[model samples]
Target: MRNLKTVYLFELSSLLKKKAYIVTTVIICVLILVVTTLPTLQSIMGGENTGEEGAFQEGTFGIYNESDEITLTHLGEKLPGVTLLPYESEEALKEAVLEEEVSSGYILKSSTDYVSVVNNVAMYSGGDYLMDSALRLVNEDLALQEGGHDVEAIRSIMSGITITQEEPIVLGKDVQNNYWVVYILIMLTFMMIMFYGNNVATYVAREKSDRTMEILITSSDSNSLIIGKVLASGTAGIIQALFMGVTLFAGYRLNYRNYDEEILDFLNMNVDPMLLLVYFIFAFTGYFLFLFVYASIGALMTKVEDVPSATTLVTMFVMAAYFIAMFSLGLSNESIILKIASYFPFTSFMVMFVRYAITSVSLFTVAISYGILILTAVFTAFASVKIYRFGTLNYGNTGSVVKLIKTALKDDNGR
Candidate 1:
């Protein structure tokens, strides 16, 4: 463990000075800031009001009335925030629609029938729905008028009978509010482990390729070298993550009022602090565990070009963990697979946090999961040092992982 701090500082300083790392971090921070500020920018640019009364006013539509039975004025009134332009003929309405002067056109054949036309339909085309709704109300109005009933009086009475539900007293987590947060955090953990894990592996491979590992081994123990390098990469990753996280928080806070109530509810700020703590514990522990394993894999190869092939096994394991955690989302809380995954070291990092966030989990379960993760991390770190020490001396023989481990143990026993 001698010179552990020196090795850590040297590797950290090297990472901090890399131009690619600095630029990537800055670009991600700026992107997060811009994205989080978009709602505010939209409001300032005279975007349509998202308030309830103003929500329906989206676009203009052309209407050609072939039937003299229905009133265009009353139909327009029924669809608020929508501008209705009347045309003299169906051809004129179609021309307006083709020229993009209106979103779409409606040809009213009679009180009960109409033909809708548009140049091209997009995913959210709603012109047909609007026309149908307006015509239904107009037909009802026409019927009431023919019966000598006051249509406006009846409409007012119906509109006044609004039914609203009281917010329910729930004893469960709000999945709608927590889904995005959990999804984002899970992705963050995956990306960090992948990016930084490969970085540590490549660093180890490069050192071995250039005989730097031989020189370092003479000056320091294998434990210090491997632990220092992994910690350095982890520290750099933590710095970049913190920058992005703080920027996201600050930007969201500045634009809080610009978002609608539904949005506010979905991305609520009332997250349980304990959930975040659990995430960090599992995320960092799992990160270091994988990095140590990647470093050992790096030692199994002499050429830097072999790093990708060497680390593929560990990468697959990480990907499996990510996929399983994502698949667990929205599944029933009684899932036996998820419960087992919460204690399994490899998959627990992402799955346990997700379970804690969306389901009712006991504190004892959380502690047990943590205990398993920490113990596994320690074992992996020590095992990685042993493999790295033996691999450094036994170069040019990138044998199978199982064979390499067996040989390392045989050499250790002979010593």
Candidate 2:
């Protein structure tokens, strides 16, 4: 216990004193703050807000209607709230787009054909699709007129039957509302684990390569060394992550009302406090478990260059857990696969919390899942100490993690 405390405090203090760690944490928090406040800044600068429902209101388009059959009034009616400037020729329409006089231009060849001109295509540009829909409506009207049919009468007939919900349908939860929240959290967890987990492995490998491990192991027991290292590294990572989360939440609150209404669905910052607490718990435990494995992997490497290769299997497992959680997001809480994953320690760290956040979950179920994860983490930490002890001194050709574990067990039994 004394040795564990000394190691934990020393490792933690060493990590805190590093310029790279402190600077990286500050930079990330600053970025989160700046990104969250961007909407407010844009609004203050008088930038145009283009939302889905009001997209047409934000830009102007040029039109050269060569087809006398298609009137400006009909086109205007099709695209409500859009400004259409008429051009004398197709060349003029194209020139208007090139000169930035309009967002885009259209030259009507006939009721069925038209040419669109734009200076550049945007990632989310749907102006051409909107124009196509409007042109299609105009062509249909022109065809109906040629057939001697009343266009308004046909429109009224089509618009007569509309469906309306008599009452609001209630469900256990709304997946769409909570999806981005879980997605962001999952990504945050994955990155922290991958980055800080590697930090642990690399640190151990560096110590081994420098002959520091030979001196340290003689002074301290392997159990104390591994436990203290994992605890200290996990604490540092959690501190950085928590600070960033606080920065994001603070920025969101400071600029809450400045955000576009449509964007509120995905950027909704009204997360439940209880859910956040549960996420922290799972994330902390999962991080601690992974770091111990990382530390053992680090002990197995004789050279610093082998760190990446040694950690690849653990990285793959973390990625698999990430993908599994993402895939299961849209599934029902009672899904057979989700039910199994929520209890399985390897996946429960993400799956269980996701279930609790987006849907209804019992306290008993959460307790059971958490208990399993805690036990697994405890067991992994003890087992990793054995591997760490064997591998740190063995410094020879350490095969895979599986083979190392088996050999470590045999060596321990021989003792």
Candidate 3:
């Protein structure tokens, strides 16, 4: 335990000394600030021309009323962007539509219960849908009046069907923004871990290529070295994420202060503090597990250039799982692939957390998933130690998968 602590601390210090860590952290913080401030900036620039031509032009429609006693004043008030013109007869209305003096028009025949809309132009244009909506409303009112339904009762029923959807609870509070915030946060977490996790793998590969691994291995056991490197790199990634998160929160608070009440009401930002604590615990654990895999792959590489190609398989898996998790949000039928991915070691960290954040996931499921993830992490770390012990000393082209497995097995036997 003492030896592991020494190695972990040494690795952590080494990462802090790297120029890449500092540059990457700063870049991420700036990006978070920019993104958080954009909404406020847009609100300030409100009412600018949308650059769409002919979007707000008034639509002209001819009307022929066979019932001279019935007033059409109510319909005229409802059509804000439409101009309704009077016609002497149905033929006159159709001629006006055909001549393009009006886009379209409606004829109300006294003998028939239904009204016919004369559409000479294509219906794809803006005026068609609006005219259709207006006609439907008029028909509905006519039907209700004919059925002897009270106007007040009809209005009451229409208004009573209003929907009020409640957010799913996470810990003791409701999750914010229809779970989109949680989805985005989880994705960002996965991306950061993958990015810096690869950095750790490349660092290990660089050490092997430069022959520094031999000297380092002399003082530390394989397990100690692997644990140390994973801790250091994982710490770097966590620091970057923390910096970005803080910056983003600060920027959001500053820019959205005026609209805080409305935004909070809309997003339902009532997160339980304990939920955040659990989130951090799981996030860190998941991060270390991924880092172990990354470092193990790095240990197998012969050169820094080979790192990208060697880890392509793992990267693809991570990206596929990420996109799947994103698409699974709000779907009634949860995906079987996503459910399996949530338990699988490498993908579970991102997938399960998102599920937990967005929906009413059972506590038992979270516990079981974390248990599986931790076990997998331990197993991967143990395997990585063996692989690092063998591969660190080897200087050649990248080893085959079978050869690396055999070498690691042999190293484990010796140990």
In model 3, where do residues sit more than 4 Å from their true spots?
A: 1-7, 43-76, 79-178, 219-221, 260-262, 272-278, 333-335, 355-361, 397-399, 412-414
User: What is the per-residue lDDT of model 2 for residues 219-251, given as tens digits with 9 covering 90 to 100?
Assistant: 998778888988889889888888987998899
TM agreement with the true structure for every prediction: 0.89, 0.86, 0.68
Better of 1 and 2 by TM-score: 1
Model 3 agreement with the true structure over 1-415: per-residue lDDT tens digits: 3378888888898887879778878887888887777767766778333433343335677878876433456556546766788889878888887887887677755322325555544535566556556656666666778899886688778979978889555443244444756676677766877787788889999988888888888887877888888887887777777788789779877877544455657555555554555466666777787788789878888888988878877787678767877777656445787688878867777777666655667788888888998898888778777777777766684456546666666765526
Please list the Cα RMSD from the true structure of every candidate, rounded to 1 decimal place: 2.9, 3.4, 7.5
Give the TM-score ranking, best first.
1, 2, 3
* Local distance difference test, each candidate: 0.86, 0.84, 0.72
lDDT of 1 by residue, 234-296 (tens): 999999999998988898899888887777877755778888899989998999999998988
Q: List the residue pairs that clash in candidate 2.
A: none
Best candidate, TM-score-wise?
1
